[model samples]
Target: MVLLLGIAAGLAYGLTAFAGAFLAVPLLVLFADVDYHRALPIALFALGICAAIAAGDAVRARQCDVQLSAWLMAGSLPTMLILGALAQRLSEPVLGTIFLIASLVFGPLLLLTLRAYANRMAPPPAALLDAPRRSFTDATTVVHRSTADKVGVLFAGVGCGALAALAAAPGALLGWRILERRLAGQPHLSVGTLALASAVLATLAAGWQFLFVADVPGYTAGLYVLGTTAGMGIARRAHKWLPQAPTHRALGCLVVIAALALWVVVVRGATAST
Candidate 1:
């Protein structure tokens, strides 16, 4: 049962960058009979491993931007550690409520953004559209970091870290939106950079959980790692063969489903407590 849960969680993580941690946490609680607090750390640890694998693949494919990832991490790592420590002190209900609220607020926005981008209807300026694509392998293709871009990265990092620490995979969706806005016309690079940044942030968050919160289950973690590795491999191969429009639509639907599940959990917890 534990192995099966891990595999299911991993498959969810492997399939979508935005919804993995979000999907994992609640699913862990519901399916694995884990408490919300325990589920959080487990999901974080599993997500870190999965993100690392995905990032490695992105790097190997020359799709990731190292400099961009570094800047995002600089802002995200410290914030994640601090918030993760704080999260340890919060009660399960409070954490669940927070996740529920975040899901409701951001879920629809994410869905809309995905649809807009998929349809090429996002209102990015023509100048951004004309900006040159940065090559992961070729430093010459890298553009100078503008002040605005740096600020955007910093803000996005803080938001990502805060969300990662609180509950669910807020970082992935937040990072995706930020990267998409800043790196217009370069969807592949945005996705690659988001993966790498998420990996780093999730790893740090997991480390904090291990050190301060509780000991993670080895069997579950190991199985989740295995599942994530396999899922990412499959996703990478299948992505090319799939159409973007349908994929984006599917992801949007997933965000909605996850959000609804979180809401139900929060409501049930409230009713039971009352």
Candidate 2:
């Protein structure tokens, strides 16, 4: 099960560049009987590794936006460190409640993000020469980015950090929505940039958790990491050949299912305790 959890988490990250932690934590809590706080660090560590793998592929493909990723990290890092420390003080039930709420909120939003990404058309070639508009090359495409987009991305990072630290889920669904709007034409670049940002933030937070909050089992972590590596390897090979529209819907359906499972866990835990 530990290995399977890792594979599932990694597969999700590799395919969508999001939700690795979200899927891991709930599955851990519900199936492995892991406490919310204890599961957080383990899930986050997996998320960090998963994101790193995806980001590396993206960077190698020249699909990443380094500038945007930097800004996102700048905004997310401080908040993650601070809130992560505070989270240790929260009761298991409270933390579980927070995670449940976050899952419910972001699950549907993930669908929306996917829909927006699918529906938006690529930028016209003339966009490359539009005067007074600043254009930059992301791999092979010329996309225009604005100052407002930068600020918005920063805020999105801050939001992701807060959610990651408090709820054990990176707010990548929110970040994706922002990227969908801001980087309309370039889906790979948007995914890559956000994956890079999420990788750094998750790893930093996991490191902090390891040092100050939790003692993760070496065996468990190893199993999860190994599983994630295998799952991502498969995704890397198959993602291009996969149909985009139905794939997005299927992934969205999985998110909704995970959210529903989380709801069950929270309610059962609360009932049992009472």
User: What would the TM-scores of all predictions be?
Assistant: 0.83, 0.84
Clashing pairs in 1: none
lDDT of 2 at 219: 85
RMSD of 2: 5.8
Model 1 backbone overlap count: 0
lDDT against the true structure, per candidate, is 0.67, 0.70
After superposition, candidate 2 runs with Cα above 4 Å error: 121-147
Candidate 1 positional error at 186, Å = 1.9
Worst 10 residues of 1 by lDDT: 122-131
**Cα RMSD (Å) per model?**
5.0, 5.8
State residue 62's C-alpha deviation in candidate 1, in Å: 2.0
lDDT of 1: 0.67
